[model samples]
Target: MKKSGMSLLEIVISISIAVVIFIPAMNMFSTTGQAVFKTRNFSFANSAARRISQRLMAMPYEDIVEVPLPGIALFDAPAESFFAPFLNTSGTNSGAKNITQADMPEFYSYLVQHDFRYSLSVSNVSFGDGDEIKSVGILITWSENNKNMMYRLYVYVPSL
Candidate 1:
């Protein structure tokens, strides 16, 4: 009599082949997804850093105050004024002087909206004696899989 259906051996062979092919395909898909995510985050972080740098650059050379205002830390500014536009702070008044601990106002908010975490830093560079040009650095950092991602931006401000 002729067999009407696939034999058990044939069925098992087909299932095994399918699994072998499927696992690698699935792995590839997962890897690609992770890579895409990383690329997106990098792009976002870089954009944010550039935006902040542009704002700093726009400031008049003399208006770019590197010195900490009284009651503020080094290279720090009131969060409400600088970051509020980007990060959502509850209080109308930003008493926070530290730029790091302060909640992200503008850029941070954007990152949060996109499910990305980030941090920023600004520093002033001064040569010996009084120099009209000041160097500003903006550092942005984020995280994925408990690993930190970072980007740096530098700008030179001429005296206004």
Candidate 2:
């Protein structure tokens, strides 16, 4: 009687084929996943840079130039949402909405918790044409394993 079953050689061949196909497919999936993760991180960094740049541009100009406390960097000041209204031209909640050195950590902490590392640099450039440009540069850096990423945004406020 003829046995109705796959031969041992046939079974082995089938399994081998499956492993060959599955190995490459699984590798492809993992690679795609890593690329997606990196893209997402990059997008987040870009957004954070944009957010801070917009905040600087929306300032009343005067506040942007107001020197920070001695020994403190300008960008490092107004490091909290509490100081938003103060930097802008309008709005009043209650009491003085000031940003202290203590608030700096809160801002950095917020970004770090959100998976972003942020740093900002501001400069005032006056051209010979009598045009003054206030440039605010925001840099956001983050890393995963051996992969490193950064985003820089430059916002210029021309003399109005």
Each candidate's TM vs. the true structure? Answer: 0.61, 0.59
- Please report the TM-score between candidate 2 and the true structure: 0.59
Model 1 TM-score (2 dp): 0.61
How far does residue 143 in candidate 2 sit from its true spot (Å)? Answer: 1.3
Off by over 4 Å in 1: 60-83, 87-110, 113-130
- Encode model 1's per-residue lDDT on 64-98: one tens digit a residue: 55432121211223443334345333565453323
lDDT score of residue 87 within candidate 1: 38
lDDT score of residue 147 within candidate 2: 55
Q: Candidate 1 at residue 73, lDDT?
A: 19
Candidate 2 Cα outliers beyond 4 Å, as residue runs: 1-8, 60-115, 127-131
